[model samples]
Target: MEQSTTIEIKDNSFARQFETIIPEGLLTVEYSFQERKIFLTKINTPDEFQDEIFLDNLIRTILDNAIEQRLKVVPTYPRIVQFFKKNPQYKELLPPGIRI
Candidate 1:
């Protein structure tokens, strides 16, 4: 799973997900917001969009989005939980008492 050269993500509130359209298809992070928190529940990425850098950047971008909305993140998805574990700096975006 190699990544594209660039990515552009957008919030599709109607679908309750964040998405980026690429040549292969759509890369999406499914989510639900509640009580000032955003629960990252799932991710959909075609094989062609799967690269470490791309995944890192996508997760990082979502964290940045959470920061802008002043929302804490609850990573219910295993992949996002793993991401949080690997990137400690983003842990601050997690709610208090939450751990990867």
Candidate 2:
């Protein structure tokens, strides 16, 4: 199995927008606002497994574009942090493992 990961931003909205840009089979992303972290898990089938360099570059490109677009709508870390803090209930949207 091949594996790779990156953390370029710390917001759920950005994470969601990021998902829309990537191919469905290429990756899976988990985001936690409270923890202020994002996890990108690469799901590589036996046939699709490739060199680490290729996967790394692809993920970087996807993340860079996604973050750029999302920032236009919701700019700055402080703004996102404050939004989540004010609406604590939004934390519930996160997966159980990431709720902390």
Candidate 3:
């Protein structure tokens, strides 16, 4: 059976910043201001080519690329270092199938 997963981002500000960088024609994303969360839904097509493995890989690639781009926008090394310090769990928090 195919399963869906939800990733919850605790930082509302980061969520807003993220939407700007996501590429078009990828997964469908919905944002909830009241809940302060972004919802991503995998678009499944009836075509036989659209299988579970394909959908999983597509989501992984898109999220990995988005995170990499966001890391580049960090203004300075000091800021990045400080961020990591405050959120030591960041290294562990990285999305599944992503390499830092």
lDDT of 2 by residue, 47-66 (tens): 55555454444444544554
Candidate 2, lDDT over the whole model: 0.39
In candidate 1, how many clashes are counted?
A: 0
Ranking of all predicted structures according to lDDT, beginning with the best and ending with the worst:
1, 2, 3
In model 2, which runs have C-alpha deviations exceeding 4 angstroms?
1-42, 46-48, 71-100
lDDT at 11, model 2: 35
lDDT score, candidate 2, position 49: 52
Clashes of each: 0, 0, 0
lDDT of 1 by residue, 29-56 (tens): 9999889999999999888765667777
Which wins on lDDT, candidate 1 or candidate 2?
Answer: 1
Give the TM-score (vs. native) of candidate 2: 0.29
Q: Write the per-residue lDDT of candidate 3 for residues 5-85, one digit (tens) a residue.
A: 443322235433222122232233232222322223223233434444444433444344446644322112243334334
Pick the TM-score winner: 1
In Å, residue 76's CA in model 1 sits off its true spot by: 0.6
TM-score per prediction, in order, is 0.87, 0.29, 0.29
